[model samples]
Target: MKRIVPLFFWLFAGSVAAQSPNKSSWAPSDNSTIVRIHRVEQVKLEMPFPDGSSFKNLKLDEVMAAYHIPGLSIAIISNYKIIFSKGYGVVTPGSSRPVTPTTLFQAASVSKPITAMASMALVDKHVLMLDEDVNHFLTTWKVPSNTFTEQHPVTLRELISHRAGVNVHGFAGYNRNQSLPTLIQILDGVKPANNPPIRVTAVPGEQESYSGGGIVIEQLLLTDVTHKPFSAIMDDLVLHKLGMINSTFTQPLASQWRSKAASGTNSNGKAVPNQWFVYPEQGPAGLWTTATDLARFAIGLARACNGTPRAILSQPLAKAMVTPFNDGGAQCFHLDPINKGLFSHNGQNEGFESLLVMNWKTGNGLVLLANSDNGEYLWDILLQGVSKEFGWNYHFDQKPKEWLLMAQIVGVDAMLKYFNTQKATGLSENEAGEGDLNQMGYFYLSDGEVSKALSIFKDMVQLYPTSANAYDSLGEAYMAAGEMGAAKESYSKSLALNPQNDNAREKILQLERK
Candidate 1:
């Protein structure tokens, strides 16, 4: 069974690391056109998440079971209310704590929006000027030196928006228990500083730089401006006002909170719990929350967006805060189109993944947090349930089964087990005899499973005796497999199915020459 599926090869490839060899046939769904028309219509409703229904098909319990997530939390915000917030599974899998709505999970990057809210509040109070150089209030940290470009002092807006133009990038180092360095030391590549972290290395305001250190620099300004630690500021400003009693800025496991720490599995597939409080990088990353509390935050933003009553960040600034910026990554969660936009953010540590989605219009939003690395699978499923229920545009194509089947084939070593066990490579002479086998053949073909593509095409020809496209794709698959003779015959058969087949005719001539 020479399966010819080229696996995705990338080092620390960002989420959606889809470079798989068997992942060539994704004709982005008809959803793209629908998305444009909706944008044109700009449907205004009290709530649009699941349209006429609630996103409740795959319950939290089911998703947790599938992903091995000890705990999971989700909140959907619309109409300025706690419209949907729930928790499922276990806090520790073996422990007795059934995850509750208030269970505190390590709110990874979700912390940034909290920080953004705090900063925007400061902006409203005139204590934090968005356009002013952050250096004015900051005395403890200074930008690192680099010859790549001149350092134009970064502003408060640039830091929060991830537009500082220098990505200090990932921090596989710096965890709990070790004496953490000052934010300045982290940026300067000083002692105990595990990774060099990304040096300012680029001119400020030139591009987006996703630096946790940049957020730390912003945190330091909290002290410089307010004469208090970030923890206190969060307690006084965000927690108290929002009434997020179960959530805090400290480590998830240590707080007097519940045992629902967000978690993820390591390379060995062992579940690892996550909550880092070694250093408080408020602007970039550092904050813990529960789905319930997070839903409140999302609700507040949505209310503020729709001119509904709320107090998170005032309508305009909260509107501005959701605006997108470069994060040393691709364009995603874009809230403000070419003009004003909103953004999406994710948090990931050893055992957990967290996502927060905010929309600039109608102020609708949603967040899903998981206690396992595969928690994203739950997110995908929930998004589907939401889309099917509400008809709202969350932008996830409903082809998850197809995508996951492909992902499983590409991501796992079980390919030979499943692919090699199939029956005859072509149709069984009976009409209803081989339905499941044919579906599997089609699955393999759509996913770039080269040998399977060939087999499926052969089956289609035998079963239908009149599928031009099927035969054409079969020819292309053989051509890809370096079998010119087989490809030529397949192409010729496809052209015979329809005399107007220019593409198949051309391919047939090309194969003949070959």
Candidate 2:
């Protein structure tokens, strides 16, 4: 493990943090391509014009700072092998502990894919059937049957693909000091469980509705059938088998990996209280892993998909894992339409965000793990760089909304100018919306630019007068700027516009108290 100087000093000094030691024989002979990817900072606006001037290249460190990301790690898989992996920035804002390739970050919903893979492995072993009723395998608890499940039973296939119509889209992990819920409590959504009960709400296998609660049911199924803990089952079925040594499904994380774990940070770059949330919902949200390890998992899946002998999954099962169900989901991964072979999954926990995109057929992909709420902000920019460097056709479209990019590079004034000019030309009809401006406002607020945030939000309110969210955002900006009277007024207007705006109502109460 290596330590680096604080983020401010390191960014100002333009120094490289110590690189993780490469033990893989597949390491690239020259890292010039990786260096070039790091230097890629240009943002190209997707304008109607044929020729658009590219924004100046911003360094990765500078981008990290602007986004208030404390730490990030990336791993690139090329030709069915991990060719490059590295980490950047300090683990926690002011800490000297540098993020390393092995540093663990919560996989969040990314855990779903791994859990899905484990389930598929069971299918391959004849221990579990994909189409079998999930309740058959579950001993601890069963999905409460209702009218929705009368015609179509909730099957493992449906659960894995999120077609089970289960309620609760995601889970909010418990605080470190909070009493943890058992698997049964989480499914039943009882005391100490912060979510509602997981139950089928629609006809199973009828439509796709992403439900982490559905995955928790599969977790219990695995535990019951295997007669082992979810974490142990994952270790034996997937992680250890794939040589993902740096990954674990254990909640609260193992003590041995504590020092090696990056502390989750909020969008404003502050460390999460107690460092990170404890996700007891292991199947849906509780995998702690490194980018390199995730890349290994991706590579292993790629091998299995290609019919490699003795791979973690059988050929048919592996192919089925990526095959989109009737509802357009492939087990846990989502297929990319642009590159038909690419399957990707993104994850977000309290203060962590992660993305895994891999083309199983071509064996090319990238894993990005960040200990910040705003981590996904860097994905498109970094993906562009990777696609350019590797000549990969399966990258995110390089074109970004003009105003949003302007907000990042030129600040509120330039962003508004471009936005207004485009609006005058009627070219901003689809691009410039209440949501875009609201996002821009929050970006400014998070960066501590109160006046800039206020400008954006005020304009947003003017643009969408009837939008309660716009007024609510304006109230937030006013509150951040210490204009309590204006904030109260804005919240009042928002609450008036939409009586269900509890956020605005709460803000009014707080302001009234003040």
Candidate 3:
């Protein structure tokens, strides 16, 4: 949360005039300029209008400015082609550079799908097999023998589908001036690598745990098997073949393309430290691309599924790639059942974010990229807008109703007072849980509003007195506020309520020692 904009106020701002300087030169893709322009104003979240209407028309500039998002690029595809492509907001605050359809953004975890696609190229050539043990292909560093992996070897299929039970959820990436590690160093979690060692934590094929670490191993496998650089291989196998001409998997980005890059921004509407993060782990989180370019990739894949000659994959292989290993996990790409067979993927870097979605049958899709931490939330809103305009029959998640309603009718403070008086009458565990207030407290804590956080935590404990989590959260607020005595008291209460709360017990010991 930024001090300049309150969360509730920013989320529910009234319509402001379109402030986008780039709006005047609107350039939608060929054949659908008018419809696409209208779609921009149809921006509505899942929530109904204040007066109970189904949707509300919102201006792109107003929403972007409200959320402090510096830049956004969007592309809509239909019938195996891009129907619209446009940009909103500036590349950086107070800069003359405006975001364009071609503005490159860090693709983040969305790189996984592209990497998977390239790996499929190897499979097609009979150089690799999906079901074979990945360790057999590794030449530099191998997956260490462990109790969990002894039962079943980690396979390429399991790794790509996130069923390999590997560790390391993602990478925070290294800053520009920091020493960069080799691929082997990152896998071994040796010096200069920020994340822990990539290792099997659970029985392979038993469960799915998303691991960028697993993807890194696949990256290493591709390089070892092909005897080629990861970026060069991906460019040849996927990017060039799919006509993703403006995309690259190169780390730190090339110097010639630097001028076309969008500057990364933090949640506070400020530039990220050192501008952007350098991702050496290319398989999971390294890509520089535009929304339009991603749209082309999506369209090409959808066309391939329909047995189009331009598809990089055969019809059967394309179908298998999008199919889930189990009901819970997508193999190479994510599938959304509610959106009528949409294959979707979203990614987030330190300050950049992107989303790609396409219905293989309809050949309709959306690609969105933004240069801010808040881009994730903004993308949800944009999805709702596109769904409504195109009649895509997709569902959008609703905003927190009770919180919004209470915040509007009664003040934010009134909800706390009402909770204190009403007990379980108005609030349900699902609606206004201790976790909700706990998260709100941390939001303020991250913004350096310790007093506000303290008040929120107090209200949480007052409402959910029996919950150990509530008292534990209150103790953390007290500790953050530098009130050692109160923190100790809250921790003691938490420990008394739940002896399983080792965290609270340790905190009490730490406070007494201090």
Candidate 4:
């Protein structure tokens, strides 16, 4: 129950350049626009309170420093053209090598959409069928069939849209020294493969459940059908066609490219061990790309959506890529209901994070890549700034959870008073949500504010008495405060509510031993 809080929440809560042959001629008249964007004030949280108070605006550098992000690269698309692309900070912390537009970063789950795009390209040809059972094409490894797959066979369409009902949400790539698993070993979840067996867990096509495991199956299917490496297939179908010269699906990234790749950094801004993890699961997470290269991919999709002839993907296929299979997801992207024509995806690896948002119809998009785990904290703020500057319709209306912010800016007593006041008024409070409050408690606990964390956890138990997670979190706070008896009692209550609370059971054992 003691979750790893995003650095932003702890602080507030207490919390590109590579061009394609189809490139547009549009160019900004001056550097003024980019400068203004960098200086754009931090987003103001629209408090529901009567006073309407907001936080002071901070510059981009200030925010980056606060979040401990080592490096960031960005590319922006407008009017179906890349109008701006640049990089800020260093490729590694304390290093003289500055991030450049061409510097590569791990694309993480953002690789999924590109992989999905490649699959669709196969569909466009006669090579693959979206509706056919994937097992038919999978010669090397087929999805292990079970009750969940008996009546509902998995299809490429379902896999691309995350409706395939497979297990294993994602993968943790191997360290440099770890022995790499063969694709077959990975599929069987055998030794050297860290994840469990990728198998059907629910009725396929019944609903959307993200399955990176399903994507690996797709990777194998492509390889089995084409009799080629997964990385080469992607290049042939998508990357080469789109002219994304700096992108690759290669794992243990080619030695020639390593010098241009940004070193991944932890939340504290320290370099990841051996600089980065090597992901062999190219379909789900393996990608080394620059912001400009990714922007080219986005622009290609946009052009295809506009029915441009000879685009990387056919018009029909491109439209299908953006069209949601369900309310939540399209082939590999999530459609934002509030932002019309917007399809987006975000990615996270061990010490890297990324985001890609595009309005396919208008050819407007943003790509953000960073080398630090704390990178996501800057996304919304930067998105808001970009949207404002570009006059785009994108809007992020959710007010950030500001309990930690209030505690930092004002005193804890005042923050608590405001919380109680808002609760008494019967108004929906942003800070009162179960997840938000739990995150706030974990933030405090991480900051070594044991008393503050205890108070927050106690309130969570009061607010949601029957919630097992709430009790589990309370138990963690009690244990952190060295109150063994109270910790055991809270753990007991948590277990009584939900016998499946493994963390609580583990804590109970640890406390008994003590």
Candidate 5:
């Protein structure tokens, strides 16, 4: 086991004060407007924190200054009532249009839950199976081949929940008329989704890994099972019924909605358009909807969690969707809960930033959608507000918990999107056994303890025997310790598992020449 890093927690209360150049330092006061809304009546509905505040008005404003986001929208609900729904700033950077309830925004991967709901609706009609193998209904590509010794089956649940292990974990190309490739092409990844054929490099269900590509397989599989295009199925189950009149699946950019939609920022802080809006992996994250529609969905989630799946699905399926099957990168509804098992997901693709969370027990929830990159402040502060409404407390010391728990903790960019269309809550729920061994290894490696890191890597390898990185890292650790034989053995194991592993190949060639 890797060394346990010490984490600090406070007794109660946490806050982030805004930093305004014009205003002198302001402290929490009796008359502070930073009060949270526990359950305000007559308001429209939103909040990310879902409870109280630390006087973060200044922090939120500073975020607007930092990211150059021109607009933001939010929705919140408690006990089936709309508490607050509103937008911030201008719709476009320079345009005069003010954001409103009707101002539509592209939700990106925030659209996953909607897709999940639509699929579950079909399941309600006996047209689909939640646990069926996607390969059974496919007319085109299927999950790639791997020499997995374990009999882990890839089911529909794996695709949506992100455990399908299909390695193409992301999308950046969704052009209109992009010559949609066959499902096989998308899976093989010979070209971008619909461009050429997508080749699969790993077997499905080998481990809990993210793959937007896996989602495509599930999407096409859904259509194949229903004998209808994915969009047609969505229109029937959700879009048409929820009155999501302003939403779409495939691209045309809806030039009218462009200005109202949020834009992404470069590392140096500049706006950029979404590259994937123009790829065929639209089902994974191509749908466009507003905070209102999403809030309606969130409310619907609350209803479903409370045994009200709009009569389209069972509460069991809805609960399964929110339950973490393989830690959806904490991207689309993963959990650590800090203690309890909770459901939450954050979607921040190229040009969009969004988040939604719900208490599995209380049925309270919130969704925040920003038209720019001001997600950090907008989301955290809003959640603080949400805490007030829910009478929950914010653990400030636990700030940045999700990132702290992942392999990549800096900026969130990875093609490896986690899927868990599975109904399982997790490997086992509790803050304990639910962390990334790779991440733990990195922390140990960073601390310069090679032996310690190797121990963690060994555990990880045993857990995910098919992962080349686990063996590769173990080999590196052996090499560092001057154990040439052990290093060669580990390297051989890695190469045997993944012949394409350049690092292992290079290490082996060096040993042979020596």
Candidate 6:
């Protein structure tokens, strides 16, 4: 991985580690496109789908009401500084408690990136070794020796990268009245912990797999090594250093902070019994933070990547943290390739949802928190709006729904003819990509529009004749359309193209038996 040089070292660079930007000064600048767009409540932006329709101006208030989100908080960072921070709606469904800029929400899996950052700090201080076998450092309950471990002992690096083959993709938090399990009990999947035991399911360093269970191991390692609580260690190592004063990894947040905490709500806007789900799995899904605080953490990381003096991680370690460990998986942060040097992660625990993104190169980022399970429905709109307002190079795409509208307007046959002609003329801007078209076909199938789906899959197979997946999808579409002979033919072609296509092989067997 390449080291990120400080931003000020470049030709156009002016200064480094200067004072944070003034938000009031950013108001409606007449000369700036970003300023003009920022003034609007919502801005229309293009989605990823080539054939998808662009959404018109969407209002935040309308979206919140439509989605039943009780509250939302947002912060935008520009040029290694916070440019804007605001809150919307209420802390609870029927409460008069308006969510303020300081109100905290559950950070959920966003906690993983923070945990990884703290671990990197440990690496810098020689307190933790990334490539060292984690079992050697763990003083608490040990990971059981299994067949997988005999071949390859799991390392801290692999654990953070999610290539350790750890089981348990995520955790669903316990209800307010439910008995909370100890960290060991959670790892062992005994009693109160709802999920199965965290164990290696494949050879370490095999492939990319998301595992919250792996992060929990890091949490344990941090506590055991430091002889202090995870929250306290993080505070000293990363949180306090980054000036994220409104954030903490403490599970079951203390009573004094309750008034500033946003209550979680379901899709229908009903509040959770205890206002929020309790996440004892601290490394993966336990952090209470405001968007402003998270933005501070992001800015600190950007400054660190740029080699600013007094920054948290050194340039080498920061680069490695964002570097993809196995395949395309970043150690903890999720990589967004659309924009250059982007690292992001999203989180969901019960009714609360959160996302944090930062473009390290540009020192631009955004943080969003919503107190509703259905908040995801508004993510695209909200992100695109912010991107447009700030002129950030973020890509937000949707599955092509223009095909459905086109089928309604020019008829499916006409659309098919147009798509089929792409063989010689080449794919146009409006033509669907393999994944997008495949998903669109499946959406139609799920919606019981069998004829429309068959048309789509037929086009897909025609366009991508050698694709095993395309044929498999076509076969599924055929089966749904009740054309068993056609389905069998498609499946056979799929199996021939890729013998490892278990889905096609199974479908063929079922058809043969019938």
| Full ranking by TM-score | 2, 4, 3, 6, 1, 5
List candidate 6 segments past 4 Å from native: 1-40, 43-56, 394-514
- Between prediction 2 and prediction 4, the one with superior TM-score is 2
Tell me the tens digit of each residue's lDDT in model 5 across 294-412. Answer: 76676666567668635445787776766654533432465545624346666655545677766656545676666653354346546655665556543433322232212221111
Question: Where is model 4 more than 4 Å wrong at Cα?
Answer: 2-27, 39-54, 326-329, 400-432, 443-467, 477-483, 496-500
Who is ahead in TM-score, 3 or 5?
3
Query: TM-score for each prediction?
Result: 0.63, 0.87, 0.84, 0.86, 0.62, 0.72
Candidate 4, poorest ten consecutive residues by summed lDDT: 10-19
List residue ranges in candidate 3 displaced over 4 A.
1-58, 396-439, 466-473, 491-510
Local accuracy of candidate 3 as per-residue lDDT tens digits, 1-514: 1122211111111111123735422354544557655775555433333466544444677667655578888888766778778777777765778887778899888899889888887987888888989888989789998998899999998898888999998998989889999999999899799998889999989877778899999999999999999999999999998778789999978898888888888755678787788999999999999898898788877877788875798777777777766555678776765656678888778888778888898888888788887676565556666766666776644532233223323344755665455545774655456755665566456546688678878888777789888888888888988999999999999999999999999999999999
Among all candidates shown, the one with the greatest TM-score? 2
Whole-model Cα lDDT of every candidate shown, in order: 0.55, 0.78, 0.75, 0.78, 0.55, 0.74
lDDT per residue, candidate 4, 268-310, as tens digits?
5568899999999999999999888899999999889988878
lDDT of 1 at 341: 29
Write one digit per residue (lDDT tens) for candidate 1, span 250-361: 5323545434454444322344433333333444545667776876777666566555565666787766765444443322223434323235667764456677665555
Clashes of 2: 0
**Model 1: lDDT to the true structure:** 0.55
Model 6 scores a TM of 0.72
- What's the number of clashes in each of the models? 17, 0, 0, 9, 57, 1
lDDT by residue for model 6 (1-514), tens: 0011111110100000011111232343445645543453452333322356533343555446545677888787888888777777788887766777788899888888889888888899898898877888998878778898888888888888888989998898988788999989889999989989998898888887889999988889989999998889888888888888888888788777787898898745678788888999999899999998999888888888888888889988888877765466666677765676888877778888787888889988888788876555455555666676777866654422233333433456765664455435775544445654675476457547788878888888777889999899889888888899999999999999999989899999999998
Global lDDT of model 3: 0.75
* Residue 154 Cα positional deviation in candidate 4, in Å, after optimal superposition: 1.9
TM for candidate 1 is 0.63
Cα RMSD for predicted model 5: 12.2
